[model samples]
Target chain A: MIRARRYQDARAQARSNPELAWWVFMRVSGVVLIFLVLGHIYMTFLLTSELQASYSVVVNQLAQPVWKIYDWLMLTLAMLHGVNGARYSIDDYVQKVSRRVWTKTLVYGLAALIYVLGTMGLFIISKAMLAG
Target chain B: MYRAREGQWAFALHRISGLLILLYLLIHVVSISLVLFGANAFTVLHDIYGFWLFRVGLIAVTGGVLYHGFNGLRVAIMDFTGWGTAVQRQLWYGVLAISLIGLLITAWVVVPRILAGH
Candidate 1:
């Protein structure tokens, strides 16, 4: 029996270069973020009659795994994707190739640090809730 | 060198908006999660929706989500395909309309719920 082999090259290309996918995704995601961010801000800053949302409120909501994961996904995607975008900007305007590279390196490092700290903070808080 | 103006803008905004949105999402989740963790920590969000300022904020958040999320989708497509440039111009308008509609719908749902004070 003769077997047909899949076009592994194209698939690999697509996987390696997700540019096309991300392009289409930007429109959809951007539109969605507009709503998500606006809703989020309003709820946090404007809606609460109380000037501050108590810590208890925060912990209670974080307990839901869905929300936790939602946050994690959002955080990771935005940080990585956004910084990646910034790297492009640096490349476009910044004349020096080395500068662009260095800037991106720093930007990426900062993003990583923030992600680490933020995740750790959440984990500690989460564990505290469970321990009690 | 390829002019990455649009692409770069998309990239920068993706990060800015992504970061902004992430903070909000985190807080949002945690706000609600606190209730699950401790009985004493249970904070009812019922009051939040009712506040006028929060209502407006919700509308803006809805706007941000639509803009940032949808725009992110647009850039994502552009990276891997050549068709990205062609669609960007038209899609911006399309995105705007969709966002408006979404905001309206959200308002419709949220207003009654909040105003009724349920």
Candidate 2:
């Protein structure tokens, strides 16, 4: 059947590179992100009014090591999962091989920059909370 | 390009939502980074987000995340498992149904709170 052939193609494609691994990762991470993000929204927005979700409240939360780790994990998974998904779109739409490479390079570069900045912002706030 | 089929539209939504989330992430990182400057700076940014208009925007974000996360799961299942592809179209509908219900519930809960302006 066509399904079997498509499955075989997927297996072969996965064998050739790490694309398959990432393909699987997207799903797994996506499920986890759903919970994490929903929980985050509930805690940040639903649990309290805007007045209560002040800078001090956030600082107080991040001061705890657990929150710091939870947020970092959320950030890491979200970035990797999202960037990989975008890469798939880029590869599919970009016609020329050379253009694809350049586009991916640019995309990856921006992703990395955002990741680093996010990490720094997260950790620095944690440190500041701890010290002060 | 310009395909109006369900699958194609789903694909397009996934791409668009993913990119929008990425853009939001960049802004979120930069805004949070303002905390490093001082608590006053961070508080200002936080207050801006607390504005009712921004809260409404967040409803759209919640919808985007719900759709993307659920649809991504469907896409993943189709790619990984044998049975998934067999019922892929059904699964897409299932995803839409679940996401719609979820978004509606979220809007139901959030809109009133936003209107209260608290």
Candidate with top lDDT is: 2
Give the per-residue lDDT digits (tens) of candidate 2, residues A1-132.
011224457566564457666755776899899899888877775666545766667677776778888989999999898788778778678989999999999989988987887787677665455355
Q: Residue-wise lDDT of candidate 1 within A1-132, one digit each (tens)?
A: 111112232344443456534443444455454455455555654465333445555665555687566566656655555655555456667788788778778767766766765565455555356446
The positional error of residue A34 in candidate 2, measured at the CA in angstroms, is 2.2
Could you give candidate 1's per-residue lDDT for residues B23-103 as a string of tens digits? Answer: 555455445444444545444563454577776676666666776767655644444457765787566666667767877
lDDT of 2 by residue, B12-96 (tens): 8988999898778778777776776778888888888878888887778878888888887887677667788788789889888
- List the candidate 1 regions with Cα displacement exceeding 4 Å: A1-52, A127-132, B1-62, B74-90, B101-118
Prediction 1 TM-score vs. true: 0.51
lDDT of 2 at B103: 79
Cα deviation of A57, candidate 2, in Å: 0.9
Give model 1's docking category. Answer: incorrect
- Quantify how close model 1 is to the true structure by its C-alpha RMSD in Å: 9.3
How accurate locally is residue A12 in candidate 2, as Cα lDDT from 0 to 100? Answer: 64
Listed in order, each prediction's TM-score against the native is 0.51, 0.84
